[model samples]
Target chain A: MEGLSIKQRFQETLKSVYFPFVAIVVSLLFGSVVILATSSTSPLTAYGHMLKGAFGSIAAFDSTLIKAIPLIFTALSFSLARRSGIINLGAEGQFMMGALAATAVGVATPNLPAIIHLPATLLAGFLGGALFGLITGVLKVKFGASELIITIMLNYIAKELISYFVNGPLMDSASSSYPQSAPMEPSARLYKFIPGLNVHTGLLIALAFIFLYYFFLWKTTAGFDMRVVGFNPSAGAYAGMSIGRSTILALFLAGGLAGLGGCIEIIAVQGRLMMTSFAVPYGFTGIAVALLGNLNPLGVLFSGILFGGLSAGALRMEVMTRDVSSSVAVVIQALIILFIAGRQMFAFKRRYRYRPSSEKRKGKTVVDDATEDESPTVQATAGEGE
Target chain B: MNEVVSFFSTTIRLAAPTLLAALGIVFSERAGIVNIGTEGMMLVGALAGVIGSYVTGSAWLGMLIAVFVTVLFSAIFAYFTVVVKADQTVIGTGMNLLASGLTITVNRALFGASTSPPEIDSFGIVAIPGLSSIPIIGPIFFNHHIIVYLTFILVPIAQFVMFRTNIGLKVRSVGENPKACDTVGIRVGLTRFLSILYSGVLAGMAGSFISMGMVSFFTEGMIAGGGFIALAAVVFGNYTPRGVMLSSLVFGASNSLMYRLQALATNIPSQFLLMIPYVITIISLCIVSRKSNKPLGSGKPYIKE
Candidate 1:
């Protein structure tokens, strides 16, 4: 730090920000080609419409924030689990379970006051999601089963369970037999901060959570331990930390956070527990948010909003363009992932040299170079392994 | 007796797609790449198969296009995981998203929004000469499409190749210990890349079977987690071709039973019945032989010096 000049430090910061920016631009440029090939709409006009729709009016901006709120929560979930070196692909299921529990409580009590009902419903959501996440954690910890497959299976089960619940057990009796639960009691409803706007206090809750995530992960002992376990289980075990406990704990917290996101969506946005209420692929989109944010809590907030804007605008793009569905947003999200994963292309010359040495360390160096952008602890673990 | 015959036939039919995809996973995972993108590749293949059949009016042409498109997707996966040394799981997830978005967008462009594509020609049951006449066994085994027959034939062939061939040994060795394989002059990246491609082809076939053999048209999410179920089958099968086949059969049987019970309007909620295959797969996964001979470097990318 002392040796580097101010110019070098500035350059480093610029590099960190510039790569992702370039990747996004490149992806959009490629996306335009897709738009041209698939549809007759000019990419420039379509993008103009997208920008206009995302921020055209206060209402549009409010909707964008509304969409971002859940993304922030889910992104935090993915970010937290990744910190512990676990992948929680079942955020979709966890989010659904959270919604289910919150709905169960939200719809069951129509007479309670807002002060009590809201907190209870939110708690139910967190607990539901946590419990659901814990199943995968427990399975991985106890039976050594791969959480990847287990979580994927759980997603299928959760979707079916919710479909059944809305269609049968929790079906509204008087609403023309739609596959949805009865509307929530007014007490359980979330209120908008701005009267006419779609934005709700859920944004504040999401922001608070972002702060909490940062605090828990960066400033707490448990977070330190979890990060240690994530970077290297062998080192953590050697240092007397329980890897299983950390895995369970990390996943549980992740699920709980995501579950809270689900609750907010139900109480604030949807107001009803329809089968399709949480069907915006928030959980999967969260993965994109977390990765784009470099798994940093603060980064997640910004990335979440960015993704929200993309999604919010995508609908308008679909309406204005020919054959350009909102699904193009998904393609963009995936493109971002591909770009991030393959960002090695941007760093190739700087990081690698055409050294003719046939040393074993050469291969190890390449491996180290690939994982370099990850957390410092992963770098440490790589050194130890070698 | 007739009901029993139908149930068994349904089981065979249901198992075929999963069985084929699981076989693909066996090759890829054994070669040190856990191809969770099987789902994405299958999605691509399913849509491509529909497009091919729609344009060419031949199911076989659809199958060919499915394989070709899936291979293209797999190549992207190979470049990232094999050449760039990125995280396999994340890239695979990205591939799934890419496949999902691309398929839907293309579907909207080619076919109108919210409307299903026109039904195309699909493979009907090919009753083999003498074997198909042998009562219940014949009905279950012999009365299937050409793809179904191909899927069955693939089992022993895959088993023989994986166990008896030199390429199989190289693939397995690379997964178990790539460093050692590299030291021995074996091309680890090339092996892993080819294995992924092989899985792509198999998963493509599975996708085609779903569209052309199981149904005559493509709809949104027609693959419906069949790819993941195939992954479960691979794990449950202990990564053996025969084991994958048997586990796929079990899943298929449960899936068939669920459909049957739903048709019968059983006292049990149809939703819970619908969950039988997934729940059973999770349970079976837990109980499966823990002595899974998985490659040590199964999910790790090889980095060449």
Candidate 2:
């Protein structure tokens, strides 16, 4: 890339950029068809309302930023694991566990000073999700169980566990009818940073972690080892790196990130953990964000905001056009992932490229290029052979 | 005594969907494609079944439509994973999300976001005269929705085809080594595509059984994690038809027992009871996955050199 001239570099960037742009455009087009088929309102009108709701006002932009916070966290979680060759599908469950832990600490240890209590609650949330994630990692390492199936199973188990807590021990006694936890105390809550805006310090944490994610993955030795394992476990193992350790560490950190997102969401946005708190599915949406961003940290930040806008706008679209469901946003999100995953479908031409001298080196570079250029899903599946 | 009969009967009835879906998983997995999208296919199938029945006024027609739509859905999945050579698991995950969103959208559009499910024609028990009358054994097995019997009958047929037939041999060989299969003049891509489609057919049927056979209305998220459980059954069954059948029955019994225990007002919390199948799936996966009979080339997309 550094060897390329300015024009060639611009062309290369265009090549990388065009696919996701096309995917987003195609997905929105598909979304419009659904709107047209289902609602009496014109698709254009619905989209206009959606766009207005997402960015037309300070309040709308605030909501978009707020929604993007959790997504950024989950996307980081996914990107971390993908970098380590583990598919952390349990982020949803981990996020729920994080919220549960935050609630447990937030409600139980009330009246403490903000400094101690707030950080304590946040730490609890991280540990909650981290331990949950470690369960999958341990099972995979020790038992050879596929993380894919285990993570999914853990998600269902985590939901049940949440229900058990909310209905049984953690049920808010003041409101016996509602299966929800007691609200967190002032000290444990994530107070809004801007005076009138609804956004919280969680946005700062999300931004900080985005930088950390880039730094850790690209700069640190451990991160380099994990990426090597992800690229080719056999080669990494041959190079004396422990695959088991990388898998466990990656999943643990991934879970913690998601958990922290859940924690912040509870303390800042929701105020209390309710049975229906997971209705939006932040974890799955994160996968779309991560993929659309091409698994780059900065890219995830932008895509996260974009998805946040989509959801924020979708709510208004549903209201303005009562016939249309907000779930159309989900359809668009899913389509983006599908298109990104099956990107070869969008390729119309084979561009001539420069080749390295050694055939063996060329093969390795191709795999690396595939990892960077295409969705991480391709590399994850290819690495499964190890 | 009657309670015992009812319990076993409920077990079989509950097992039918998982059994059907697991049968599908067996076919797809045997052909070297990991179908994590079985859940999505089943979801679409359930909704399509209801829509078809609502329109045609026949449960059988609903079942046919369910199969048709699900096949079309899986065909897209096949096209991506087979022709486009995308990652199967990732695409499957996308398929699940798409299924969830699309079902909710379509269901809301046609039925108007009402909380109450739309009433539609559904399958009913067809008691086989002589067999259904066999006192103790008859009620447990003989009397069920037609799909239930069809589901059980397909077990042996699937077993026969998977183990005995030429097509099954080709499918297994292709999964084991696609390049070798290609070398032997087998059309690897076509075989895999068909195997995935066959899985789609059975998964659709399984889903139809859920909406049209077990109940008379469509509910959002009705298939729940039934598709994933079926995926587990495929693994626990060691990728064989008979194994998958037994695994499905085990999972079905657990589900049936959970509901029964909850109804009986047992001391155990309903949440804990509800978690039994998922927990059991994880445990069973751990126990069975040790031998690891997973297809050598299952998750990897085949690229002919």
Reference-based TM-score of each model = 0.94, 0.95
Model 1's A-chain: what TM-score? 0.90
Assess candidate 2 and give its lDDT. 0.86
Clashing pairs in 2: none
Candidate 1, residue B15: lDDT: 93
> Scored by CA lDDT, what does every candidate get?
0.83, 0.86
Give candidate 1's error at residue A277 in angstroms.
1.4
lDDT of 1 by residue, B126-154 (tens): 99999999988999888888888889889
The DockQ assigned to candidate 2 is: 0.50
Top candidate on lDDT is: 2
DockQ of candidate 1 against the true complex: 0.51
* Weakest ten-residue segment in model 1 chain B by summed lDDT: B296-305
User: Individual DockQ of the candidates?
Assistant: 0.51, 0.50
How many clashes show up per model? 0, 0
Which CAPRI tier for candidate 1? Answer: medium
